[model samples]
Target: MADAGYVLPDEELAQLQKLSSDFEPETTGPLVGERQSSAAITTEYANADPVYRVKTAALPSKYAYFRTCRGDGHCGWRAIAFTYLEALVREANVGKFEEEEARLMSINNLFNNVGINYELIIDFAEEMFDLLHKLAHSVSSNDGNADAILLQAFNDMGTSLSIITYIKFLASAWVQAHPADFEAFITTGDVKTYCSLSIEPSQCELDYVAVGALSAALIKPAGFAFEIMYLDRSAGEEVNATVFSQPTDQNGMLLPNPPTIRLLYRPGHYDILYKAEDFPPPVQQQPIQVALANPYNDSFIPSESSVDIMAMIPGMYSTSFGHRWPSVPYEFDASPTPQAQVTPVQPYTPTPASAAPVNTSRQDYMPVHASHQPNHSNTGRHGLHLEGPPVTLPIHSLPPPPVSIERGHLTLERGGPFRPSMYELEQINVPSFQTSIFKNSQYNTAHYMNPDFQPEAWSPDTEYGAGHKGKHKPPAQ
Candidate 1:
């Protein structure tokens, strides 16, 4: 007979007890979350108590960013482990990682001094060393993925657990070896006994004594500073800071702005923290200019290459040649067969005509217009006669006065394999040919059709001379 309240039957009570025992609190997020702005912390406590709101609001001003660690029992250890490798990564010094591995190996003596068996801790120790080697390789090669490697390594439960266990062993060994320092803090009055129960146990979270021991044994010797900022519902407007180590030189003087490992501690859990200056801003890569291979024709020479080659040949380009041919517009007759005819003109030939044919023949790949024949010409040296209106070749300068020398006695000397042309002899006292047939023809010195083309030069003195008179004076007045 039960009392006033109804009592459950024995089978029902057993089932309820089993259900309660089997229940576990649901946990979410990655093992170690991505680094993000610390402002999120302020937003998370926006509707919370006034003390939390004030503290979190001020957090981002000093510490620009933070990274979360899952709040399992191992968060504190995992956070410190993650941040240690991270600080090494930020340094980006391969030699330092090797030195750290060596230093850690040397501390195996500490484990031996405390009577800890090597066999028991070798698997855990190997994981830490392998990670060190991997990070060192990444930093040395400048793969630009060292941070991602570190994040992934810590996120892996097996690797993360092994690393945490290794550090735990180190903390325990350091405490036991330094009994005099930690003996007073241990309530059990035995250093080894306290470490066995508190530090070495797989289930126990990292305690204050272990943090101090790890700071002494691992971090301070490596020239890195470690800090933990406590965030809690205390009376202060901001979280409190506790520095475990400060790097110093051989003289015990503090080093200036050495790399620091900072952790944000909120009661039982820990996360990583960073100031704005922890890393340099990403650099934008400049585009590289590549020289593409010319694919149109192998025999065709580039303009620049031609200029360079011509410069090397003597007299190919000469100062004696007064003016260079200005780039003139071509307005030649397009008529293929013009019925218009004048007296049968004799063909003008150059002593260098043989080489010209070879050069022109190789340039067959060039676009050829029917009106402008680069390969061969049949009508005359000046060009063919057509019925179109006269096209004036714009003359920028006056031509040099021709000396009335004998055509037979004239001898033009040029460099290389080229010889003189008979038509190139100066045509002295020849009347100006302004006919429709000769306009824009090769006869013009400014035209590219002439091999030794030179622009005509203007003489202001001759044009405005006091003694100068026009060809047709005004009625002999």
Candidate 2:
């Protein structure tokens, strides 16, 4: 170490300062991060220079979101690669993924023409193709998980490096193919030599020439526009954008409003940019309407002990049938086993005029406990003879509870939702026997107006046990 008192010469001091300025620390964080509101960019520059503060302040008004790319030397290439796949995902078309894979496969010939060895790039190309396959499956399955899958694949160091290398080679091959278009930008003038030394190297950052090549070779043909917004000390209130490619039709007519892959370019780093219009509105899930099968046939007769046949005959009884209850199928997640959907039971009002008839005999409609008996005082209504007090239906006559047999090994816990039974909903227009003591009482299940009304029953076992309690021994003897 140099002594504190020692003074360095001007030439040596200049060399040391240059080395220090050129050195960059190793990058950290995910290669690509989650998409976040671009207001974060403005906040990041709150204490920064006036130019940066002014530019970033106007950023969120136009670009609603920004995603970070790691500041490693390959960020430019990584940004473009990631955004290209993301744009395809935004398209939400399974066919587009296949089309892109085939187009990239054909580009192998370009590599061959440019003297890039097939074996050298095959491993990297395979990684790229594998991601394409996974994304295609996600779209076709309607999993709505392409965003998560794409983010994870890019975060994997091995997969990310392989894909970055693959694109670097692609850019190199594209540049070599069209010398006239890019030769002027190449300082070395020799296209082959420039690509070998700079464009195709694994550690080199992406440059203007390579970005243009990628735009033409990969993005434009995939029906996407390519743009880069330069945020710098440049004289502007907003960041300046340069459009490298705009998708066009076969007739060379410009296509309007194509999916775009935008990048926010700093002096030596690159991140992704997006407008509010980039994302489609979230799909509002309508309740899953399960169309029930046909009504029971005449041959299928109800047992003698079932609810009076008059109640089953629509318009004969004044009972109001509730709405068609929506039963939601379990929502399958990214995991192999579908996580159970725990939908809250919504109270449905029974529409009298247009509502279809629902089977009241289904177990979900049956009352569990027997306490309150059915009303039987109608004199001439519905052409029924007034019978003695309604009797309790026998337990054997009740249908079995509906069985929900899940396909996989998912063990449903008690927290899982169940449809609210007919007896569980509010009983409207029914006579209320509310006294001051019984008002809002949980123990009022016996009341006819109770939401959980149950028909009263006499149990033979309880009666015999109570009457013969003390005489049992003498009887046995």
Candidate 3:
């Protein structure tokens, strides 16, 4: 027996055994197992892939342990994706979403210049953006709930692919925007050619050029810091590691306490690595029914701390909350089958938290109300309205478009459509092509899919008016 309550499932146990004896990408959570020492990795690789054994032998001291990701080409992107979510779970705030959203929005200029579409992946991009922000805003005492949300979102097939693919796309955009910076390193004729062959492919492991551009793009714009432990067969007694992010120019060191994401890189793969003893014990997920039984329960509520999308509703949220939605009191109607037991059948939508329509539309999905029902009486540009007395749902709750722009000739490659000799031909999780479908579709105003949506020109501070704003006439508000 493995351990009293820790018996691995038949398939999982088999995989673990295979991990020690073969070369395969880990296709699960980044921080799943306890941090394992480099010695353990070496021993595991002893009977497995000879290359891994050679690599593990060179890990530096700081990289004594690791969390390995699957080696299926996209490990680098997946590693970053996992780290971002884990950071959010750790923060548990909702408002964190809006900040991230805006940061990403600000980068539309960079991406537009790189020749990618902001339309196809926009919905997924926004959800992930909001997801992280909300987690930062949520202040749940039970962090396990936060952990569950992070894990669930990443594991969801649609989310997993959309997010990982987007990260890959972002890295590609960065490369295209700054081709001159990466020109010397690329083997292909141009950045676009290299990207078609490597970066955009879901399963292509990141190369040196991709790593630099992606590190700069993700770290600077997202405003997060990171350090990666490199365990390769290079000449080293322990795992080699390095920090990548915004550092002060004078002394050249990372700022203090900026939500660091630790990752382990062993040649072809990357994975998340948690500090052995710092964070609190991980919270476990509770059963849905038990969670819903408590009206004040917060197990299912999406973190709304940062974005405050809920707050956009007249009385839903407030900034005063430390890390959670303020609890409101409400009574539940009692039925043979308690009304609290009704489960929602719809997937969570981040657009605006919508109420299940009671009439003909989605009539099957209904929340049992004590004295009030959702008066989606009015549908506005934002979200459906929830009129009447407010109900604090802890037990249960829940949570498209096209674009424009241009494109280029994409010849085929492995794992991607355009990479030359790198990624293999495969699937397109988040298409990077710019289709000409938006013939005056009003999305052009803010979206960068059109050439007209050019970013405002920036300038250095300069002396302008003799008479400043003190004498300026106020425009109508």
Best by lDDT: 2
lDDT of 1 by residue, 174-204 (tens): 9988888887788865888888999888777
Provide TM-scores for the models. Answer: 0.55, 0.56, 0.46
Global local distance difference test of model 3: 0.44
Deviation of model 2 at 1, angstroms: 25
Winner of 1 and 3 under lDDT: 1
The lDDT-based order of candidates, best leading, equals: 2, 1, 3
- Candidate 3's residue-wise lDDT over 351-389, tens digit each? 231222211121212232322212111111111222322
Candidate 1 Cα misplacement greater than 4 A, ranges? 1-24, 283-477
Residue-pair clashes, model 1: 5
Query: In candidate 1, where is summed lDDT lowest over 10 consecutive residues?
Result: 285-294
| Model 2 lDDT tens row, 1-477 | 576456456557889999997888766766888675564565455445656755775576567668888888889999999999999888999999999999999999999998989788999999999999999999999998998999999989899999999999999999999998999998874999999988888779999999989999989999999999999999865799999989999999899999999999989989999976787534221110010001111211223333333245343233232111101101111222111211123111122321211111111222211211222211211112112212332211111111111100011111112233222232231222111112111112221112221111211123222321221111110
Q: Report how far residue 245 has shifted in candidate 2, in Å.
A: 0.8
Error of 1 at 410 (Å): 92
